[model samples]
Target: MEHSDYDVVVVGAGLVGAGVAAALAGTALSIAIVERAPPPPESPAWDTRIYAISPASVRFLESVGVWQALDPARIQPVRRMDVSGDAGSRVVFSAYDAGVAALAHIVESGAIQRALWRRVGAQENAVLVCPARCASLERDGKRWRLGLEDGRSLSAGLVVGADGRDSWVRGHAGIGATLEPYGDSGVVANFATERGHDGTAFQWFRADGILAYLPLPGNNVSVVWSTPEAHARELTALDPDAFAARVAAAGNERLGRLTPLTPAAAFPLAVMEVEHLAVNGLALVGDAAHAVHPLAGQGVNLGFGDARVLAALVREREIFRAPGDPAVMRRYERARREDILAMRLVTHGLQRLFSLPGRLPAAVRNLGLNFTDEVGVLKNLLIRQALG
Candidate 1:
């Protein structure tokens, strides 16, 4: 078996994983990225899977050179956001009011992934190990070794687990995670709105669930309807026209009639929290470290936060300290705990509050929304945090 040595080994070449490798391009550390599949082929049709990229995340992508590679025509900037409570209460946020250019950018998942792949592939100090699977991971004195399925061995000072929710590295390292399934599925699709979105995003917290209309470039938008599993099944099973009409009515036809731009798809929802972000010779980023309810549209943003923080820490570490030094791991955990905990608690609490069937609960929640809306300082504070 061929053997290799590196300063960092990153597992899973998804957006966050690739971001980590790409972000460390000019660093002295030699990096290796392992993935089971090659980068996805480019597609002209819009991808149904999309994410709201926070301003802070945009800067991270830019630093890694992935942002510049993205096609400007495909990106959509969000100027305003309108959120409504089921009990007829509402809150509005504007980028102009916050003194920012835009709240966030609505981007397709594939575009970012492809861009990151291109950057990492060209990075001088990084090696892209595609179509590779991890067979075993074990400690070798001061370093960690990864055994690949294709009879190759990789030894590194640091192992980064950017794998998805069910992370093999996290499991092998004996890190525990608590998962709370919401018993709901997020149904997503794209549509051509009868009216333009005007760079505004809309969200409704309803008895059925939370529905969000995220604007795309031109007269198009993407919708994420988080509802019960049964309802999600029904939504995906609907004919294109029927699904579009139902979605239009749910959002009060605010964007007018809708025409299907893509077929609908759905995925189960859950909240995950890990016991530790780092151990002696290993660290977890993105979904591997934590996952939150998507209502706030911050899951991927949090993952990007993980990638950025981890990369910066590694790049700036003292010469005497290794990438997986105990002190470095502690710093990474300490830096991220507060942000991750706050987002998890907030999203989970909101989901439970809206899921309660009692009228009193609904009244109180909506009242709180309205009150927060009226408080300019409070609303701006929330927006500022979200902008990150």
Candidate 2:
């Protein structure tokens, strides 16, 4: 097998891994990105999988030149968010009130991946290894050597696992993860609305589950309903028109009638926590490190945060310290623990609180929402943290 060396080898060229490569583009370090599949093909049709990119992530993408490459027409700014509880309680947050340009930008997952791929392709010190998989991994003193399925061996000072929930790299490194399945699936689809979204995002926590209407360009919105497995399967099995109508009614027809723009899909929901975010020569990013319930719409944002922080830490490390040094990796893990824990706690707690069958728990949760809505200082604080 041919052998190669790099300062860093990132597994999985998904959004977070590609973002990490992009973030480190101008640095002096050599980088390699290994992916099991080629970059997603460009398409005229909108992707059903969408993400709400936080302002902090926007800055990170902008720094790497990916944000500027995205088509402005395909991006939608979330100016306001209207959240309602099952007991007729509601809380509204406005970007203007938070003194930000927009709460977040709604972007297609494929668009971000494509843009990042383009940047990585042009990066001077980065190489993309498409259709490649890591068959095995071994420690080479302070570095890690990866044996690819294609008969290539690559050694790197650091190995990064951005390979999603079932990370092959994480498993190879012997990192243990605890997974708490939500026993539900997140159903996603896109639709054209009769009335304009006006840059407003809506979310409802009902007895059935949590439903979110994320605005898109023009009279369109992307829907993500986190519901039980049976309900999710039933929703995906519906005819296009019936599915759209069901979704429209679920949101109280807030956006008027709906027409399906993409076929519905469902992914099982779970919260995952790794025993450690980093080891001597390996580090985990994105879903490889942690995964939280998506009810807060912070899953991708957190992944981006991981990329941003890990890249920064590596770049700013002491010159005497190697990238894979245990001390250096520990710092990255330590810096991320609080943020990951906080998100998991919030999302999981909300899910449990709302899932209770009794009327008292429902009333208490709704009352809390109403109380938070009226508290300006508290709401701003929450928005500020989310903006990060």
Candidate 3:
């Protein structure tokens, strides 16, 4: 088999993987990105799948040169967030209150991926091995040997898995994962709202589930309704007009009449945690390492954090330590443990708390929201944590 070698091999070219490659562009280590598919084609219609990029993630992307490459016209800054519980309780957060220009930036997932892909393509030390797949992975003494589906082979001191929740690399590396299905699906779609969102994001914890209206450029908004499987199926089955009507009603007509800009899609909701983040010469990043509920819109942000920390650790490793040294990889895992655990606990706890079946529970949770909102110091701390 034809063979190649690199200091690190990344088995995924999604946003997080690409970001990792871009972030390591200036490092002395050579890197290769193995992807099964090419970058997504551009479309005139806005993508329904979007992510709220946290401030820390924004700085990471900026350092990697992906942020500046994105189209500014398509990005929307979240100046404020308005969250309402099933009851009458509501909590509001403003960027100004947090002493930041914007709480977060809402951008289409495709845009970010494309921008990062472009960066990786131009990166001197990064190689894009797209339209390829890892057929098998094997341990070669102190290194990793990967066999590609295209009959090519590569060796690396370290292998990074950024292949997402159903990671192929993680499975091959003998990593086990525990998955908790929420019995729900996240229904997402784009809409042209009758009223302007005024650069504000709105969320509602309703009896059905949690719904969010993320503001977009102009009068557009992206909706993610996390509902039970049956309800999500019902929503996806509706015609465009009917779906629009149902969504508008769910938000209490907050955005007025809604006109679908794209077809609605739904994906299962689940929290997945891996047994171990790294073992020997392998490490996991992004959804491959961990996943959380989308109520907080922190999933992608967490993935970006993974890339940021892993790249930094790799860059600062001791000269004698290989990129895949167990001790070096452990540091990256340890640094991320608390942040990941805290987010999982918060998102999972909120999901369970709201799913309880009783008026008392609803009242208590709503009251908690109100109380948290009233505490300026506490809210700022929460905001700062989310910013990372």
Query: Best candidate per lDDT, number?
Result: 1
lDDT of each residue in 155-255, candidate 2, tens digit only? 99999999999999999999999998999999999999999989999999998899999999999999999999999999999999999999999998998
lDDT for predicted candidate 1 compared with the true structure: 0.92
Predicted candidate 1 versus true structure: per-residue lDDT over 82-146, tens digit per residue: 99999899999999999999999999999999999988888899999988999999999989999
TM-score of each: 0.98, 0.98, 0.98
For 119-142, candidate 3 gives per-residue lDDT tens digits of 899888989998898899999999
Worst 10 residues of 3 by lDDT: 313-322
Query: How many clashes in each candidate?
Result: 0, 0, 0
lDDT score, candidate 2, position 22? 90
